[model samples]
Target: MALAIFDLDNTLLAGDSDHAWLEFLSTLGIVDGEELRRANDRYYRDYMNGELDMGDFLRFVLAPMAAHPRRQLDAWHCQYMQERVLPMITDASRALVRKHADAGDTLLIITATNRFVTAPIAVELGVPTLLATEAECDDNGEFTGRSYGIPCFQEGKVERLRQWLGARGLPWEDSLSTAYFYSDSHNDLPLLELVGNPVAVDPDKILLATAQERGWPVLSLHGSCHPVT
Candidate 1:
């Protein structure tokens, strides 16, 4: 069976989870709503332009998790899932996932979003594997506001996936033969190029152009979800 890898933001989901999480926190008054939103918007713009500084963005996003207890963060995340994330999940996305499943392809969701925010969403999608940027933890099992290892973005996604495959005794070259990666951002081009089949789902402007030039399949999973930006 082939491997199907899906990007979390704007591909399988209708929107960016990292941005939504921060917005949820701002609305709860956990962080300064106006300030965080302005900064978030800036980072998001950078991301859309393919110029995001992952280091700075991670620090900004993870700081709030560092300040709060795990229990409290978990509670807020539950609410965030119900209010923010659930709506982003759409029937089209679910059907795409099922399409891969019915074909006996291994399902994986890999995203630049941190694991704390995405793990549950993976569960909701019924995808059994996830590769996400890991947030560091302290001795007390609390977040340290730092990322662990490499942030899974751009070229790093290729590295992270390679490492994951190596750990599972799947050789990098061998796995690529049957691998299919679906993404919407130009930033994912590195991994997309490495896979056997790369599908652009509701791709951004730059990615759409690249996909067209490369003769890659362009898909639209925005059937019932919010229109992909």
Candidate 2:
């Protein structure tokens, strides 16, 4: 079967789910609101500039979950998916995923966003596989405020995905055939280049330029997801 990978943040949805999740948490009064908001804002700035430190970013993102039980977090996430994420899953996004599903592709959502933040969205899209930054948990099943594996960002995305396929005994190097990855960020360029078919979905300036240069297909799930500058 052919492979179809999708980037979660701005590609499949209308906004950055990670940022939205942080906002969701901020309103719940679970974490220190001011501290969390400031850190999130700083990290988002770093991320936009492509200067993010994955270790620090993951720790910042996962810290609130450390204080809570998995069941509680899951409950909150269910609310989050219903309230925040569901609205962002536009008809165009669902159709894009369905197109691949109908083609019998091995669909995957590979995102830099953490599994806790993006997993439900993947489920909604009906994709069977997800490769996202993993949050580490302690012996008591509480988050440890650390990452479990390589953060799937930039070139790390390529490495982590290869490791994922290799561990499954899937042929890594030869698997790009009929492989397609749809993404919207310059951060995803490494993975976009690795796949045989790279589709730019409502791309940023850099990715748009690169996709044009490489003759990659351009697609739009909807209008620009970028916020007002």
Candidate 3:
């Protein structure tokens, strides 16, 4: 069966869930909210500029999970999903996902955002498989504020996907027949290139230029998700 993979932020959703999660937490007055916001904005700028320091950025993003209880964190995420993620999800994105599901393709979200922040959104999108960065935890099941393995950004995304497939005893060639990856950022170029169909969804200028040059299809999944084949 063909695989229909999606990038979480800016492709299916209208905004960045990682940044939004941090902003959502800020409203609760946790950990120097102003400074955290400034840093988060700076990192976002770096991401847009294609200069993301995945190592440092992940540490900052995951640190709070180490201190908070799992129960409280989950409750916060539920609220965050309702307040932040739900609005960002438009009718078009949902339609795109349903289109793939209807076609019987394996739907997955491959994002650099940590699983804790992006997992429920994957569920909200009705996608069953999510290949996202993982956070490590202590023996007691408390987060240790560290990444478990490779950071799922840039080339890391490709590696992680390969690893994911290998874990399922499936090889890359099997999925290459008609695999599709939908994304908006140049950061996703590695994985995008690996797929049979690399669709640019409301692309940033850099990816748009490359997509045009490469003759890849550019489509929008924002306003109203229509069937695109």
Candidate number of the best TM-score: 1
- Which has the better lDDT: candidate 1, or candidate 2? 1
Which model, 1 or 2, shows the larger TM-score?
1
Give the alpha carbon lDDT tens digit for every residue of 129-228 in model 3: 9989999978888889999888889998888888888898877877855899999999898888888899999999999999999999988877544344
User: What does candidate 2's lDDT look like per residue over 158-226, in tens digits?
Assistant: 988898889989997678767999999888888888889899998888899999998998888875453
Global lDDT of each candidate: 0.92, 0.84, 0.88
Off by over 4 Å in 1: 224-229
List model 1 lDDT by residue over 1-229, tens digit each. 9999999999989899998998999898888988887997899899988899999999999999999999899999999999999999888888889988998999999999999999999999999999999999999889999999989999999999999999999989879877999999999999998899999999999999999999998888876333323
Question: Following a full C-alpha superposition, what root-mean-square deviation does model 1 have from the true structure?
Answer: 2.6
In angstroms, how far off is 14's CA in candidate 1? 0.4
Candidate 2: 10-residue stretch with minimal lDDT: 220-229
Report model 3's TM-score to 2 decimal places. Answer: 0.94
Off by over 4 Å in 3: 224-229
Please tell me which model should have the higher TM-score, number 2 or number 3.
Answer: 3
Order by lDDT, highest first: 1, 3, 2
TM-score per candidate, chains pooled: 0.95, 0.92, 0.94
Residue 138 accuracy (lDDT) in model 2: 80
